[model samples]
Target: MNDELRLKIEEYLGGIMSTSEATLFEQEMARNSELKEEVILQKQINHHLRDDKLNAEIPENEYTRRIRTYVKSDEAAHIKQVLKGVEKDYKERVKKPRRKNLMVAAILIGALLLSGIGYWYTSQATPQELYASYYSTNDLPSVIQRGDKDSKLAKGAVAFQENNFELALNYFSEYIESTSELDPFVYIYIGVINMEQGNIASANMALDNAIDSNTLDSSRGLWFKALTYLKAGDTENAGLFLKKLVESTTNFNYSKAKDLLEKL
Candidate 1:
């Protein structure tokens, strides 16, 4: 089957198809024996993939070997060529007595293996661990202060800079309470702190508030909100926000957003 049909089958297997799409697909499957057979094969693959007993039957190294054994001839040839290039580069570096190049090549290979393994492992990671990998507070603004350094917002900025998240959140909350409409960055900081505190839903709400503001850094709110979803392991919402950022031509993170959307 074509890639579109194959993806539809996979989505059906994953139970992600919309009701209308599923109904149409089911009707199509009734009339197409090949589609029905492919669906069955996909279901079997999914079953084995998720079966602890089937997975535990073979050690990881044996599974790796099995996967290698099935690599197409052309793909194998391409991989061999890539490895040969690395080998040749390493030998040349050794001949020149430049150890750094050899180290770089070894690192390159290790990174390839790690990235492939990491992708699979990341998909199965808990929300907390994923958050640890992706969540980081943005740098503090550098503009001249409009308020006194002793002000609550200023104290919050200082606390945030020092990584004292709770103190920062409290100070920002005080400042927000005293102001008619606080800076968008205040809500962003509050959201980040809430996320670090394991209050994901609260963090998202704070970020939504930030995004609805009229501040110059408004687009950054969307970026951080998408990141919040990513930390929560909600790829669908993360992709949605990232896609939005990519579509916003004036956004500073547009290119990065596009790259991240592709990865998701």
Candidate 2:
């Protein structure tokens, strides 16, 4: 590409182009396949360079110099050609309006780049980072009125929703000890609380009890167990549980487990 076209692509990718300019540029890209490919290449290159960990590992000037050199190499040319093919196939298979097509084109290129870089990203991520990314209490059972507000179960559930894990644990423990026929979900609450507190062994034991309960929600424990292992950086064990989760479409977080399995 000529220097002026390259500069324009950079400006567009950089979001420095004004509204009218961006609109015109998109129109230009629609008519010019080569411009679209160049834009995709630049976006991917920018993404790699902007990665925090990558920037930390390599000196700024040196990394930029190396990346610029690679961008001008035969390997990058081959990649652009491959991207061109991907765009062509994607366009042929899916029909959408012009603006939506442009958006999908960007997304498709991003997905392609992610596929290539996913392993590197996953490997570099700390176990804690992965856990933080996936672990959420929002989906957990919420407080329900069990007729008596003073009941241990009600108290525990309320505390859990309030983020008072310590209080919740105590209430949950009391509830478990008070009954022979325990609700399997009580064990899940305890497991999640323990896991949040970094009590991995206690968390695993509680989760195991939930799983072994064989209730309708037993599969819920499996998902947490996978996450427990993931939080511990035990990818092998995590993958095993994640695989089990994906076996049934009805399993809790089946699609999410499948996606997480790919990362593992």
Candidate 3:
């Protein structure tokens, strides 16, 4: 591709294009298969570059193995040659006034080559793997001792902790039906139980209730909702909720949500 076209592709993928510009670009891509291919290639390159800093720490042999496994096209060979040239230029220009740009270019090219492996691995991760990696019940509130021990909420909490999801759901349902003043946390518990049972639609409904509760811990619902989508392999929807969680520093699991968003 020409340098101008390449730059435009980069800008488009970087989300720097205005809506009208992006629409025009999409129209152009639809009419030009080569342009569309270039755009896809640029997206792959950007995906690999997103975690460049982390890829820098990988051992060279392991990195090379990964690259060999995932990248076999002539384009990859061209990228290798370009990276070598950038490295050579960087070494030769280390003491010059233009060293900064050379350094950045070298790093970018090196990362482009190395990080494809990481990107491939990330892309290969199953939705179940992602869910298992991020999901945990440890942070859930302990409701066993709250209020009366004989209360339905307390029984539900105990059942949930014991992995008796069916019993927990029953007790939680009873608790909800008995009260005009709903405990938002109970909805969260219901959501978690339903999610564990693979009832995605029901889980989402309960989570929605928790969010609409407008209570202090309402943000917790966002995190669980993201996990629900992740478990269901609906990463696009998962990202929506994760983005909401990361918008406020005080939001539950804000840092984790931010990290997960990057992975997605």
Candidate 4:
């Protein structure tokens, strides 16, 4: 408010005031606290306004104009300096978008890798191929042993699968030559294979061998014999063999035989 006090405050702020000015200001502060308070406020305003990073966005020309305004009005400088923090120079905040982009790209790549591996696994394995890879599905090993392709019994099974009755009969007959141990089911399978190839008479003969095993025929073997008879259009013989399975208390195949008989 006074010329002397204003000049004294300016000199003190510029670091050119005498040491006596500090003592005088302390005494003056007790007498006129308002002026001392105003001087203290001016110093705080000058500190923040002088900081460049605090107002990085103030254009060069505008900053020079603001500096001139501050040199003239201490009170206006305080208001403008406080506003410096309000318009924060936020170039560092731009990095947030880049971080989000990287995160999305990482997720996309992970999903693609998982999908590719899944597709590759399925493409290399088919259901039938998986089945053929195994030697057996039931508890028994394969009917044909490893590297037993030359065996007559093995040949019969292959020919039967191919629906070649004439060739299957020859191989099966040869298998029977050394095997009193052969299960009657083997004969029943040959008969069924024969019927599939349209050899009704040979099918009947093969099935006859299954039923006349002379020893205890498997209820399963007898069931297949009945099935063979049904295929040959001899329902009477089919029903007879089927009754064997139906009547056997311990026959696991009895349920299937009864189901088949009901359908017949």
Off by over 4 Å in 1: 1-136, 139-146
- Which tens-of-lDDT digit does each residue in 1-264 have in candidate 3? 799999999899889999999999999999999998888777766768785443333335887887876698787888799799879877776656475566555644654454444345455566667888888887576677577889999999989989999999999999889999868789999998888788898999899889878886688999999889888988777867876776567888889887786687
RMSD of 1: 20.6
Q: Among these predicted structures, which one has the highest lDDT? A: 3
Q: For each candidate, what is the lDDT?
A: 0.73, 0.80, 0.81, 0.60
Q: Rank candidates, TM-score, best first.
A: 3, 2, 1, 4
- Order of models, best lDDT first: 3, 2, 1, 4
TM-score of 2: 0.52
Backbone clashes in model 1, listed as residue pairs? none
> For candidate 1, lDDT tens digit of each residue in 1-264?
799999999898788999998999999999999998898777777777878354333335887786877685686888788789879976876788556555655654654454455455334556446546545544324312857888898898888878898888889889889989757778888887776666888988788787778676777878887777877778767766765565556774777766565565
lDDT of 4 by residue, 1-264 (tens): 878877777777778867887878768877887986777776766767787345333335887997877777977777577467445533343446686556555654654454445334422433223223321213122447633888887787677667676787788777788677755656766766665555766766676675566545555456555655665556555555655566545653677666554444
Looking at candidate 4, the ten consecutive residues that score lowest on lDDT are 132-141
> Would you list the clashing residue pairs of candidate 4?
none
Q: Which stretches of candidate 3 lie over 4 Å from their true place?
A: 1-124
Summing lDDT over every window of 10 consecutive residues in candidate 1, give the lowest-scoring window.
135-144
* Candidate 3 colliding pairs: none
